[model samples]
Target chain A: MMPDHTIPPSNIASSAARTVFFVSDGTGITAETFGHSVLTQFELRFRQIRLPFIDSIDKAHDAARKINEAYTNDGKRPIVFSTLVKHDLSSIIRQSNGMHMDLIKTFVDPLEQELGVKSTHTIGRSHNVVDSEEYKNRIEAINFSLAHDDGQSHKSLSTADVILVGVSRSGKTPTSLYLAMQYGLKTANYPLIPEDFERGKLPSALPLFKSKIFGLSITAERLSEIRNERMPGSKYASIANCRYEVNEAELMMRREGIRWLSSTAKSIEEIATTILQEIKS
Target chain B: MMPDHTIPPSNIASSAARTVFFVSDGTGITAETFGHSVLTQFELRFRQIRLPFIDSIDKAHDAARKINEAYTNDGKRPIVFSTLVKHDLSSIIRQSNGMHMDLIKTFVDPLEQELGVKSTHTIGRSHNVVDSEEYKNRIEAINFSLAHDDGQSHKSLSTADVILVGVSRSGKTPTSLYLAMQYGLKTANYPLIPEDFERGKLPSALPLFKSKIFGLSITAERLSEIRNERMPGSKYASIANCRYEVNEAELMMRREGIRWLSSTAKSIEEIATTILQEIKS
Candidate 1:
């Protein structure tokens, strides 16, 4: 294996070419995964310099140095697709005056603007876990409602691009990715929070993707089984809680006109095909 | 958050209910990615438990323990899908009296038998590198010619499932995974090794999935660029050695009736979609 520095530098300073730097504090592999998909939604010519394996601020500087060298020879403003979690890549990017996106900011800013709350912080891969007291409370309530899942109650409604209003522990994430993987449909899933049932309203995001949405409901017992694997000490893992959430979410999805499915018994392939069929119909 | 221990033992003890295990020592996620596809093609029912982060003999034992528990209640023999480069789980598995297969053995066994070689005792992920003295000697007298990629040769191939068949750093792995996650396909690739080219054989496994194979050829210059990223100073990273290997592999693939695409000057997406179309048709 040759060292990265030994490769002769490309003429990155060519005025006509634009740099699309994919930046991240973790391995830039995921950004490349998501960014590659996002890039296809555009037609701009760009180069991909994956700045992977960043775990600290100083490492961020090292990654930034490589990007700077790439830009030194390339005249166009670079379009950066960044997943920088550290505090300084923003400054490095800003200083470059390039066309760049800060991904953490993109996800966080919109979420804050839409929900009016700052996200709770987490270390490493669990960073996406809910961090705020309010959101945490809402998540708990949702977790509570998902405990009472009843299968057929939420069956006949249709108003979601990809409805993922499911009980806690239902197979939603894998199914959503499968739908996207096997088909090109835009998918969004919302856990049917307990508040949604109490207030008799769908979570806001579901409504936005409603016309093409489809719900994912699961059996109470199965929900208990899956949740038991994640955090067993809590009441959330109790069968009774799982039963409550399932019934409530099913009822809420039913009342709100969001079509749903019983994911507990369905295979991932089946869930994906079902969603594809519902959307196509 | 759920607890892993609470999974109820399967009550179905009939032969039809036997659970198969798919295990890998490194990134069981990738191994299962391929394993699940194969399992889906068969009628057998199986359970999937990834044992990634298996760094030592103890870790392998721990994985075997979990796998044993999963199969403990079943009446039929457990069929294991396993890929292990080291840290053998063989002894632990043998104790369980279930039918388990190590993938490397399953794949390499037949090749060894047919080639009549007792095996040169190779190690690790650099499966096809010509760094070995034996490999160098083997290729010296052989010349199976194919097309040499000129860094700009990806324009005309119309049917590509993301053409990727190359030596390491020839940019095949990242490019293929990008295509799969970006453009869904039943994509398959075969690396062009010195052995394959020297013997003028398509490494028998490929012919089984031939229609889906797309060769990923790279420019000698570009390959040196990538090779340098890992080893700064070595014969392997030398531009002259790279040029020789690239020309040899490309010529071998073309002459032996395998089609290919270049990874020298294309963005990840271009390489992805172009080859995607090739294999799609």
Candidate 2:
């Protein structure tokens, strides 16, 4: 699988492309998610390839072959981020021609030492339904978030753990959903439409739950860019309208003593984390 | 902070409650998420406490105190699932009277051995936005999923990476949002309403992208229970109506040769993973 000719160092430097592999015996999501988190610290560009459900020796060999191919083709060692629970499978990937980081194997030994108990060393246990109650809470939170999204239903507003307030595209939906999915928080989001801005006050339905509202603020330029993608050339997508709405929303939130955070530079996880902190505090 | 009194062995055996800590310098999400996955393998029930943004020695000391409190209150050593990147802070947590599993410490040495390169050993690097393009993709995917949720907007259906079709309350919204959040996939979900079931076919807008269609099915019992939560004692929440809708939806999907999975026993992550696999194949 090795390439016949080596690319010039100048070409390699210019392209700045590296191959990255996420290998796992299960969904590979955990490995990929944390792996990306680590990889982001490096400035190099990467082409990611995920090989999930690599439960058997055959699958592991295939994965190793893929990693080796990437290494040979690129004339540089590929980086493999793996979460294989089985020692044999992990070892196979570790032996491949790549810089390997096996998440499960790396931590299991220390966990065993500290616990003074033999690790279960199980596979496919991380993502499975081991506890019915946790599963139920997750599903219930998802349902609650869906029901209360964009203020579609207020009949159960009292049940929400937190309600997110923002303009049409200040990123309320994704943040609400992230809170639900990650933390099992029953999140409800309300968009501050033009009518709400003109009214210059909180909605009638929100007065009772004023304390639960956490506002999201975004830059007008970013809002305009997002709105333009949804409805191009519309007055709603205009920067002027966006700026007006944002300023008014902030003013209203401040007057009502609702804490607000600008989401222009924050990721959904960061935004959700901030909201979780706000609600908890 | 050791417990002054011995908890009765009988009570401990019967209740089986333990305290679990997910400590990290960043969001603590990686620790909490994969820690839960690992903890679920054990039958024992845990009260989880998260300590995030522990980037300082002072915060680490506070975290140790909290862990010690859990140990004393529970009359059992707590389980510490940590992802501390800094050595000094990790050491402080290690000194606490809990079974500590430090993720970064466990993996970094081996990674250094394999790569022959020193890790950044940096705090707050994992979750920060180091790659703007990846961040943009995630935000874009989030926007796409929200816009197309429950067939709210079909204007850009063709742009969807995957289109999920399922009956109401069959767990489409959360699954779609999870796909977008985790995989950065442009997912659009459509509910199979009474009209679609009456027509006994896939939606008119779905055929052109037939290959992208994946269906979610749920048991009538579960569907009824879910619906009853939203609209109690109504026909929409009736078991008979749920059975009819689910059956018709499955039939329509089968007739259209669309692959489907039952979401009754699956989490949103599982459902999204299945859909991701379906689309990939």
Candidate 3:
């Protein structure tokens, strides 16, 4: 019941660190994401806990007890971000000595009223495996992305939804995987190496799939920092080498008429969204 | 402004299919997720569109126009799930002919009152690359995961946060990548083939990391179905072979006292969360 000491203290001296719980009947990913997004607007440190699969009444009681204990230990009300679907279970958590934010019910009631239809009130529906086809496509996309990473395979390049061309450490692999995992997009990432630059042409397999190809570029300084982490003091990680590679890659993309973006300041989500927008549009 | 005929009609005879917009100044991922979770409670069909990076006033006006157009085209008010931080932008969107669900503001107001603090009202904060160390760790974990997938290397087995063992098509690779991408966990997945079952022991390198190992099992029917998608008529897709492999894998996990789960009915999120709970606890 003790406060989690792992969380660093907040800047506010008058208030103790608040214990925040992401309680859900499902995997709790949505609740955690929603809570994290809202909490980022404030300048406070929170001791975070995730209590997933609180489906049964007994589990709900247990979660309520834990929330109450945190409140008692911290001498402040804990923040509970809940996505529980069942009315009884959510009511139990709401009774605890904490500020319970029923993230789902808060919007669901209004939606039900607006639509003039009652909700199903099903538990674990958000992350459930009801749509088997969608699930299979996601798994297939992940496998395809892994197989095609860094141009490891060229047999099925035509099947790719999008192909990414970039220099080493220009944020291609992570972006490719994100697109595959989140959107079930088959992505193949090929690194535009110095050999291709010397040849002054695209990779052999890339010319045919030019329309589906998108490019990613990074600033020389940022690319050097990333590469240096892998191979310190090597010519590959040198700033001059990075500058030349970036310049050549940009020129190549321009000549090939490939749309590109710099990933120096963008997160994987932003990069993936931009790519999806470009390709779909 | 015409109705998108690509979307099939809703089951309801009288009402038309609704249009849902996930509008945000950032990637709109959070808004889309939140809206999707809420909408799943209903049986009505919706054509969802994501409008990300609506940061500028001009873009906000354009998004408002799109929403209004959808309302006019569909003869039903479109549902707008907005996470806009700027007051003027949100107000403009709210003035449109749609039901605007200000997801962030609804919670932010109550949170500000409870904490007696004003929010920063920042844009693009959730998925922004503001925390460089955390971002670097995520990228590193991703690279480490890709390199170690399917037991591709034994060089850094000891560095893995958790290692997964399962038969082919038992859902290990996707789970490993999900753990790595979402939680920054370095996960290595190894397939338990007939060789391991015949030997009647864990993999040679796995025994060294026994404490960090977890197992996944699936029903024979499900395993056969999945494998059949890859190789239609091979022995690998036969129910008898799938049954034998799954039985042997379960026995191996039980004999070794390793914790495991049935992935037959679980989504990747559920499986990954369960594994994270098991390993972390």
Which candidate leads the pack in TM-score? 3
The alpha-carbon deviation from the true structure for residue B133 of candidate 1, after best TM-score superposition, in angstroms, is 42
Indicate the DockQ of the complex predicted as candidate 1: 0.01
Q: Evaluate every candidate with DockQ and list the scores.
A: 0.01, 0.24, 0.47
TM-score of chain B of each: 0.41, 0.87, 0.93
lDDT of 3 by residue, A173-245 (tens): 9999998888888899999999999999999988999989999999999899889989999999999999999
Q: In model 3, what are the clashing residue pairs, if there are any?
A: none
> Which residue ranges in model 3 land beyond 4 Å of their true spot?
A1-15, A126-130, B1-15, B126-131
User: What residue runs in model 2 are displaced by over 4 Å at the alpha carbon?
Assistant: A1-19, A55-79, A86-100, A116-122, A125-131, A193-200, A219-244, B1-18, B56-61, B64-78, B86-99, B116-131, B193-200, B219-251
Evaluate all candidate structures by whole-model CA lDDT and list the values in order: 0.50, 0.77, 0.86
Error of 2 at A229 (Å): 5.3
How much DockQ does model 3 earn? Answer: 0.47
- Candidate 3's docking class is acceptable
lDDT per residue as tens, model 1, A87-202: 45555654654555564554444433422334332222322212323223322222222221222123222322244657555766445444433332324455666777777777
Please tell me which model should have the higher TM-score, number 1 or number 2.
Answer: 2
lDDT of 3 at A78: 88
Model 2: per-residue Cα lDDT at residue A205: 85
